[model samples]
Target: MPSLRMFGRDWKVAVDDLAVYAGVAGLWHVVWVIVEIVFLARATAESDQPCIDSEIHLFTWYMSVDIVCFLLYALLLFYTLRGSILDVGARKPAIYILYGISAIYTFLLVINIAASVLKNQFVAPCQDAHRERLALAIFICHWIFWGVWALAALLAFDPFATTSVEQRYAARLWLLKCCSAGASEARPGAAEHIGEICDRAYSTQDEKMESSTPMSQIGALMTLVFTGVDMTTTDYATALILVRNAQRMDREDALAAGVGKPEVAPIPLDMLEDAAHYLPHALSIYGWASNVLNKQDIAAWGCGASCVAPCTGKDVHVGDNMLFSSKNMTIQGVKVMTKSNPETDLLYMSWDNEIQGLLPYYICIDRPRREVIISVRGSLSAADWMTDLLVLPVEVDANFLGCDPSSMVAPEDVKIETTASRRRLISAHKGMLGCAKTIAADLRRHKVLDAVLKSDQHAREALKHDIYKQDCSDHQLVVVGHSLGAGVAALLALHLRSVYPGTRCWAYAPPGGLMSPELSAAMRDYCTSVVCGRDLVPRLSLSNMEILARQMIECSARCKQPKVRVILHPGKKWKRDDLFKPEAEMSADARKTLEAYMRNSGSSHCAGGKVIEARDFLTPGKLLYYEANDSDIADALVFTPQFVDNKEFAKNGMLISTFAVDMHMPWMYQMAVDKALDDAHRGLPSTRVEVAKLEGTCYAPEAAAQTTQQAETDIEAAGGRPS
Candidate 1:
């Protein structure tokens, strides 16, 4: 149980460490063999005799070096796996010997590379000349391999004496495998030895977490990135460690407070129908705004032929009643909203202006529905995708929401039950919040709301059309978007709610980590989030991603070594389906680990100390999950859209579902909504009939009646008449 030290610091060495060393050395030996063969061929071709003594001596020396290194690496691997070299007294010496061998091999390779380059450029050239070039090429490749091997050794052994929590965890996992191997050999005290190492490693990491600041950790991550580590992998590992530590802290806090799981109720049929009604409106805007709708399609909607492109066959048709022509929509009132002219004053006015900018959105008046719709397009440009990846929560300030400074109140003065408001700080997704603020400011600066109201008044006073005759105040302000746009739409709705009390948001496939749970809950009355099947976006968050990483690591630990492929024939084509099965079965241990992790980390808790809160960032507002029913008969496929009482609907964040990405498509949501409506009209029984009955609900005639009544009530509350 003694701490194994290298130089002045402690080291955690394991037999599994031999794997990296052996693999690198094996590759170098293979390259050395190829170089020697080329040299031998050149020597034989130049001489009339079979061989020259000097050339033969040089080739023999090269082969000898390669064979000796190969044998040494194989011997070390054999002893390490056998638990002979893992003895506490011998492990340090064994590692040192391995390092010595690598150094000697690298020194010899460098000499050979220099000699070959000199001969190729300045020395007497061979008769064929091609063999000399081949030797030079192999020498260069060998030097590259040597550089990689040296870097691997440095990182694997921590030669610089700097270690991180991620490195410690990786070392511990490696030791765990070594211990398993030792136990199979019945090596005495192996389990206890590994356990002690793990305990020390965990305590060291905990101490580091307690003392370190987020800024320092971020700086260290940057340093690692510059030092040859993959930036994405390093970032993910750092985030995962931080989240896991935070989760542990949160669990302790929850246990101390005696808190338990909260109760979750079933969703009502009326809410499902309400979300369905706006589904088409939310989806159709993307097509029109992105220029997927052709000139003919826009002209068919009674708008002039301003569009240039021919029909692309991707035009979104949402019935003749729904109008989304460029003439009807304006971006900052500076330009008619079109794909070719989407630029606005607020386009490059955000923090992310360096990387493109906020996606352009349009405001249009829906005369038939008496609604002023602000439709934000989903992630299309690089800026939009960048916005999606900026999941870090930033404090929501008055300026960020385009709020009037005079109207702002202190946290203590506000009587809201939400924690964010009470604490005087609201946080939202950094990128999405920025986009929301820019959009809000542009709307206010352009006086777009006033323009809409004036247009309504003008229509009523002059045109006197029945649809346009509705009172200006009666026009509902609705914000609709999909994917990244959906998140921004949710935040925009919250900001505008104070000024425009009747503002509503229809967020389709919005990110799961858009806002704090309390902030999300507060917006339920005004916002509706539509999720289809097992869409990944609505389930993606820091906590969920950490859980996924843990599951993957556990699965990797249980995975057996893959069978080596032996290709005996050339030009043999493999069947694509046979090579890559779509429906691969997961190992039993992996499945169990996945289930256990999900069950354990499905609750919210306050994470104190230096750790960021492991709190779940919930989807804003009432969540309507459209679970697709699997049926062999495509004609008999049923839709099951229902309101979810808790975020559990998106809790299983595993990316195992084949439809995870497909489900996030706007068309998928539209199709689901359409089918749900058809089922409601037909009074078809729900797929979850038993659960619906248990909840005293039926998706038949009675449910349809309730939906109608609820829609009327909602319309009356909004100061408008039902259609």
Candidate 2:
């Protein structure tokens, strides 16, 4: 017998303290079962129907029993079996088994409840003996379940039970000592090293102490950062390419006016063929074997590796319909996995599109086993070429061989190759200077200030009057455009501070365009440009849109984001009586112009359609339409059209107008323009544009100034300056 005093109360157990706790826990279990039986009977009586006539009575009984059982099981498992209840490591097995049994039993109980309800749904009630017998069986099963559950719970905390507190405490102390000893053994190794390995190890340990950081986790983070930057850079490049080549009003001006140099030169077919000859031959592997990206054919080098074990054409199942070009050489293997697990075979072999011929030899390396598999996929010459060129004195590791293998090997050993000589030169030159040139070219193309001065003399005069004198320009300079105009606005605003020295510009709806890193930074510094995320016009290449449509389909297949997006805006309001034509029903000439604009911008053909909808062109939806206030598309439009009966898009809506509309809902662009004009008339002089010229015969300084002043006065009188 053992005696214990807990919280000033004295008690004695027949065996030990562990058994006392177990007995107390078991006693609660019996009470719970008895209470549950009483509830089930009470529930049946409350329903006012006999158990045989009412299946609902049975359902309530099952649910009530299970819910109580679930709570009790959680309490017993956590409070008694899970932690250092009686002992530490001593009851590990019992605790785990108890949890497993509890989980399965709970699932079984839920299933039983479901089955009973489903069966009772359509079945007719009967006053038969079978009905009463079934109801009685259900009740008995519920009681038996509780009994078994209690038995398991009691068994889980056993061995030194029925009063064994002394042994339980001793077991806990022993386990703690073992853990402390193990921890002490690990400290010395951590303090011994101080090199790169030690630094890495220390960092790893520190991270673990704070929170664990796995290598795979680190790899994913690094991958994401690099990929994001790379994608952004590539996008920038693509935009520049399209903007430079795009055949549009602004692009044409940029090119013809020589404001910006063309980014790429058209290469002759023969030259392209010649350049392709020097391309590198190497296999490209993207991730694991998801899907093959390219399927072009080329003549194979005889001694090349094949996915198949035996190198025979008879065994190869490559499609016969696949055509091989004189410039391209391809040797494909049927996808297969050597391991029992089916996912090992990912993207295995790949080549760049530039070069076409396959090399003479092939070699395969097994990563896990560290073995090499070599076979001939091409002619004997190819194999001979490889044997002569690819011989190495050292054995290669299979891991190194399979992981991003390249063609640093001998000529014969090389199977796939591509050359970036031209592209490399372009990248080296374009990397730093590209962005700057893009903006500069756009500024020259639009001659925005000059055009503004000519078209709206009063606007220019207003800018020059009070603002020019005080240099505290209150008016916001918002530059808005579609296609070329957008690019012009972006570039102008980007270089405004430097070019004009003090000017600030705001640009809206500029497409993605190339800018040098320096220029991009400068743009960020100089101006604030709002980009509508899905605007396709900015992406359109200035080249041939119709032809590029085909090219984009192929590019989209490769899943590369286009450098620029091409957005198309249908023509604004026609003459008063002109028949309205939707964009889908536009004339061929209009289509061609739109196509050309997109092609030059380097627009890619997306599967569904354009990225942004025409309705949500500028600003956000909430501000654009009053009905949008509810944030639900199901809501009806608030304002009906005043002009011609038309859809939202068919109205004379400009990107600037759309943007303004969003910012100030219920007020249209016309109202805004009227207000701006009124403000200008009240605050600033309505006439200020002046044209000054050289004074003298292009010689003496004093005479030149006097002549320039005279010319300025004459220009003012001629209405070149605001009246």
**TM-score against truth, every candidate:** 0.55, 0.18
Best by TM-score: 1
Steric collisions counted per model: 0, 74
TM-score of model 1 (CA atoms) = 0.55
Q: Rate the local accuracy (lDDT) of all candidates.
A: 0.50, 0.28
Candidate 2 runs further than 4 Å off: 1-54, 60-262, 267-271, 274-723
Candidate 1 per-residue lDDT over residues 503-531, each given as its tens digit: 89999999887886657767877888887
Tens digit of per-residue lDDT, candidate 2, span 1-723:
112222232223111213224435445545645655654555455455444334554445465555554554444434333221112233334334334445656765665666556554423443245544554565556656656655654543333213222222223333433321111111111111212221231232434322312221222222111111111122223322332222222323433555421111111223222112111111111111111223322233211223221222123333333212210133322222122111222111222111012222222233443322211111123222211111111111222122222222334433232421111010111111222243344334433333232233444353332211222122223222222223333433334433344443333323222222223333343333332211233222112122233332222222111111211112222121132223454434334434533342221221111110111122110011111111112122122101110112111122222232242211222222233234334543222111111110011233444434443443333234332
